[model samples]
Every structure is written in structure tokens, then in C-alpha cells.
Target: MASLAALLREAGHQVSGSDEGVYPPMSHFLADRGIPVQQGYHPRNLDPVPDLVVIGNALSRGNPEIEWVLNRRIPYTSFPEALKRFFLRGKVPVVVAGTHGKTTTTSMLSWGMEVAGLRPDFLIGGIAENFRSSYGKGGGDHFVVEGDEYDSAFFDKGPKFLHYLPYLAVIGNLEYDHADIYPDLESIKLQFRRLVHLIPTEGFLAVGGESPAALEACAGSLCARETFGLDPGCDWNADGIEMTEGRTCFDVTYRGKAFGRFRMQVVGHYNIRNALAATAVLHRLGVSARDIGRGLESFAGVRRRLQLRAEVGGIRIYEDFAHHPTAVSGTLETVRAAFRPERVWAVYEPRSATSRRNVFQLEIADALAKADCVAIPALFRPDKVPEGERLDLDRLVADLGRRGVAAWNLETVDAIIEKVVAEARPGDLVVLLSNGGFGGIYDKLPAALAGRTETTPGG
Candidate 1:
């Protein structure tokens, strides 16, 4: 929504909004763009009555702003609806979607196209480090977007991707997610199938072949398709993967022929899988292999995807948006392979709607076992899920113990910090994971480690 606001503002539209608990990156992004934002929602906030209200999906019938808009009969539409109507009509929509790697795949594709001199406008879920923003206003035919399977506004219950009109869609990987809206894996597959059904016959669907669910979702795609992965049989495959201190080098092949040798600052097999999907799309668009390699090298990656928040007394602190078991394992595997640190500490916050539940309990425990030690705080938004559905922290700790991983289920931010700080050594790597803000622990933990009040995170 923040990225859309920026894009709308850049297009000379007057935009303002009211949302509570706005956090950094977005809060800072809005302020940086000079977008006025009311702290909280109230009827008075809409007293002047704007020309139109783009009601967010998070706001429903009970929201004060929604109530005011309905009571006054003010014009209103969902964000995706407005986006499709205003911006996507005459453009080639390149949507990257799935349960994981949407942000990275979108960012990678966006950056690669930009480097090839196709400045396609893009909107990613997180800030792409190469662009320094989650959005862009490039003068190109493509309108790249992160295709979210999550529902649109309350008025529109369909997935947001359905409204985007995808000319070229990339399904990085699909799995059960957004448990609040989706009842099971089949529900999500239904949405993806719907997305694929809209694609024109001339368009393409680039899918991750390694994930059986992703392959299953795209099974009925009517458009041209390419399977990308590290496996040799994939239409787009990467092999000879090598990881160094600051780079991951791999050889790409297309249908058994050498496509290119690519090197990137991104590491781990999962991220390499993300690269494969993006590379296939670029190739389909006629981007030269040389240009794609250069783009991969230049792409700095998205913020909070194993981003180094701070380093205090030689102990490195990294932040990642890895809440799912697959994502957690990928992140830990990346850090272990790339850094070779003394001991790694995995700090987690079961914050996402799905992660806070018991859906992936055993999977999450196995993923966290990759770390030498683990620390997790009380689940965020635990009240939203029924008591029977909440994640079993006690069982998780015991499971990690059985796997030889020292685990702690701390109750507060201070306790988590104290436990890690007391044991961390100079060469160790500590990664904090969450989809939402982990109660400002990123700042607090760094300051506590430095014995100071403020410490800015960079690189």
C-alpha cells in the first residue's frame, strides 16, 4: 500500500491515509516522500471527505474510516481495483507470485530488466536495495508487480493477482499460506489456477520445478511454460554452485545448453532457485545472457532478507523476513554456507498468521535445528488463533533439544536479548526472523549489545 501511494503520488495524484501502528521502512518511506499520514483512524480523519477512498483489506466493516466512508456515501474502491483501473490497462503485467520468494524474485526480475535498459515500473513487497525503494516509475512497457494470493479488500474477496491481468506470470513456489483466508493447500492452488487461466496464450508461466505443489498449481497453465530449478532436467537449471565469502557463483543452462555463468551476492539453494525463475523470464523477454549476468551481479537484494542490521564487538546481527519453515531453513542454510561463522543463533518471532498457528509445527522445529542455538519470544497475535491452534512452544523447544539444538522460549524482549548477549561470542552470527516487526527487538538487541541507546543498521 505504501508503494502504491508513492506510485500514485508520483503520477500527480493527491493521496493521504490513516493507519495505526505504522512501522519503519514504511513510516520512514512515507515521511521521506512527504505523504501525510494520520496516526490512527477516526471519523474526523475523513471529515473533509476525499474524492475517493482506497480501502485497505486490513480495514473492514468495523473500521472507523470504512464506517465514515459508507455513512457519507463517499466514493471508495480497493487498492488493487484502483491499480488495475488506473495503471495496468495498457501495460504488459509481469507478476511474480507464490508462497515464498515473491519479493526476491520480483526484485531480481525488476533489477535485471532495468539493467537491460528496460526500465519497467515495479512494485515489490519490500524495498529492493538496488532501487532503494519498493517502487519505480520507469518508462517501459512492463508493469512488474508482486502478485499476492491474499484476498483484496473486504468488498473483493478474490486474490489481488486476479485483478493484475498478468501477461507473464512467475510462480516461484506455492504452499499453504495466509491460513486466515485459506482453509487448506487446495484453496491456494485454486487461486493460482485462476491466475494462470487469465494468462494469454502468447504469454508464459515460469514455475519452480523443485516444488511439487508449485508444479501442480501450474499444471493446467494454457500459456507457454518453463520449469526453472537447480535440477538438470529443468527447462532453466543452475549447476556448479559455488559459495565464497561475498559471492555465489553458478552455471546456468537452458534445455541442456549453456545459457551463462552467473555470480551474485545472494547465496543458498533457495535464493538460487529464485534467480532461476527470474533468469527464465528475462530470457523469454529477449534479454541477453551477458545483461542478465550483469544484473544479477549488480542487484543488492531486498531489505530484511538476511540483511545485516548491526555488528557489535565482532558479533554479527542480521535480520530476515523468514517466518515459514522453508524460508527459515533457506536463511539458515545461506548463512551457514556463506559466512562460516563460529556459532549461529536463530532468534524467531512466530508473528505471521500462519506461523503463529500449529500448521507447520514439526517443519519449523526441523528448520530451526540447523542453528547451534535458538531463541523465540511469545507468539505475536496469539489471541487471533484459537488456543488449540496456537504453536506449541514447549514442544518446539523439546524437539530442537532432540536435534541437539539449544533452544529457549523466552517471554519478553529483554529476556531474549539477555540470553543471547550473555552467550554470543565474537565470531558468532545472530539472525532475527519475523514477518512483522518483532517488538522493536532489532533496535533494542543491538543497543543492548553495544551498551548504548541508538545504533543504526546498514548493509
Candidate 2:
């Protein structure tokens, strides 16, 4: 929604928005663009009514601003439709859609095209380091977007990708997510099926070879289908992957032919798969292998996806937006491989619509067990989820204990920081995982650990 403000502002529309709470880096992003933001939603905020309201999926009819818009019969549209109507109609959209890797893959594709001189416009979920912004209004015909499977808005409970009109789409990996909206895995697959069928015959689909569900969703599509993953059988395969000294190196092969040797600053298996997805699409678009390698090698990852915050007293505190079980596992795998020999701590906040529920309770425990020690602050908005359906903190802790993994349900952010910082030793990798800010632990933890004055902050 903040990105929408940027694109709207770029299009020369006077725009201001209201949110219950807005924080950096998006809040900072808005301020930087001179987009005024009202901190709370009220009918007054809608005064001097705008031409149109881009209601995000997060806001419902009950929201004061939404109520005002409805009562006044003011024009309003979902974010996806707004993009299609204003920006995506004439452009070639390379929509990166999946349960995971959307943001990073979209960022990668955007940067690859930019380096290849495509000058493609892009709107990523997070800040793309290369672009220094989540959105761009480039002169080229291509418009790269992170096609979220999440709904467009309360009024339109359809997938956002449906509006993207994907000329080329990449389904990196698909799994059941957004449990609040989706009843089951097949229900989610049905949406992807719709996406695959929407692509033109001349267009293409880059899917994850290892994900049977993703493959199943793309079955018999009109567009050309290509598979990419660590699996050797994939259409686009990464072989002999090695992560050492802060960089990952691998060899890429496209359908049994050696494509090129590539290296990246990104770590972990899923990220390698993400890079492959972007590479496949870029190659099809005429980007040279050398250029792809150059683009990826210099690609800095998106914010909050393995962002190392500070190194204090030899304890490296990292932050990530990993609220799902699979994403949590992928992030832990990345850190374990990249910073080998360092004891890992996985701090998770079951905050997402899915993670807050019991649908993946056991799976979440299994993923967190990968870490040497784990900590979880109480579920975000516990009252919103019925007690019977909410994640059981006691069960999660006990499950980890049975796995011989020390786990704690600290129940609050301050308690978590207080405990972890005191016991953390040098060379420990402490990863705080949450979709929200984790009560600003990003600064609190580092500040507490920095009492020695020898700590260094990392970007």
C-alpha cells in the first residue's frame, strides 16, 4: 500500500494515506517521497476526498476510512486493479508469483533487467537495494511486479496476481499459505492454475522443479513451461553449490547444456532457486549469461530477509520476515550454511494470518528445531484467532524440547531481548523472525548488547 503511494505520487496525483500504524522502512520510504500519512484512520482523514482510494487487502469495511468511502460513494479500487488500470495495461509484466520468494525474485528480475539495460519499471514488496525503492516508473516496456497470491481487497477476495496480466510469470514454489483466506492446499493451487492459464501461448512460466504442487498448478499451461531448482532433473539446474566467506557459488545448466557459472552474495537453497527462476526468465528475454552473472553477483538482498542488524560482543543479530514454517526453515538453512560453526538462534513471532493458526503448528515446531536454540514471543494478535485455532505456545516449546532443541515462549519482546542478550555468547547467530517489527527489537537488542562499545552495526 505504501508502494502504491509512491507509484501514485510518481503519476502526479496528490496522495495521502491513513494507517493504524506505519513504521520504517516503509514509513521512511513514504516520508522520503513527501507522501503525507495520517497515523490513524478516521473519516476526517478522508476530508478533501481524493479522486480514488486504493484500499489494501488489510483494510476491511469496518475501517473508518473504508466506511467513509462507502457512505459517500467515493470511487475506490483494490491495489492490483489500480496497477492494471493505471500502470500495467500497455507494459510487458513479468509477474513473480508464489507462496515464497516473490519479493526477492521480483527484485532480482528487476535488477537483472536494469543491468541488461532494459530499464524495466518494477514494484517489489520490499525495498530493492539496486533501485533504492520498492517502485519505479521506467521508460522501458517491461513492468516487473511481485504478484502476491494474497487477496486484492476486502471487497475483492480474488488473488492479486489475476490483475497483473502476466505476460511471463514465475511460480517459484507453492504451498498452502494465508490460512485465514484459503481453506486448503488445493484451494490455493486452483488460484495458481488460473494464473498459468492466463498466460499467452507466446509467454512462458518458470516454476520450481522440486515443488510438485507448483508443477501440478502449471500442468498443461498454454505458455511454455520451464523448471528451475537445485534438482539436477530441472530444466534450469544449479549444480555444485557452495556457500563460503559470505558468497554462494554455483554452476547453472539449462536443459542439460551448461549455461554459465554464477556466484551471488545471497545464501541458502531457496535463494539459489529464486536466482534460478529470475535467470531463466532473463535468459528467455535475451539477457546474456555474463550479464546475468554480473547482475546477480552485485545484487544486495531485500530488506528484512536475512538483514544482519548488528554484531555486538561477537553476537550477530539478524532480522527476517519469516512467519511461515517453510520460510523459517529456509532462512535458518541460509544462515547455517553461510555462517558455519556459529550457534544459531531462531526467534519467531507467529504473526502472519497463517502462522497465528494451528494449521501449521507442528510444522512450525519442526522448522524452528533446526536452530540450536529458539525463542518465540506470544503470537501477534492472539485475540483475533479463536483460542481453539491459535498456535499453542506450550506445545511448541515442549515439542522443541523433545527434539533436544532448547526453546522458550518468552511471551513479550522485551523479555526476549533481556534473556537472549544476557546469555548470548560471541559468534552466536541470533535471528529474530517476524512479519511485524518484533516491538522494535532491532534497536533494543543491539543497544543492550552494545554496552561494551566494541560492537559494530551492519547494514
Assess every candidate by TM-score: 0.96, 0.96
Q: How many Å off is the CA of 439 in candidate 1?
A: 1.8
Per-residue alpha-carbon lDDT of model 2 for 295-379, expressed as tens digits?
A: 9999998988888898877789899998889999988888888887468999888888889999998999989999999988988
Model 1 scores what on Cα lDDT?
A: 0.90
Off by over 4 Å in 2: 452-459
Candidate 2 global CA lDDT score? 0.89
- Candidate 2 colliding pairs: none
As a whole number from 0 to 100, the lDDT of residue 52 in candidate 2 is 91
CA-lDDT, candidates in order: 0.90, 0.89
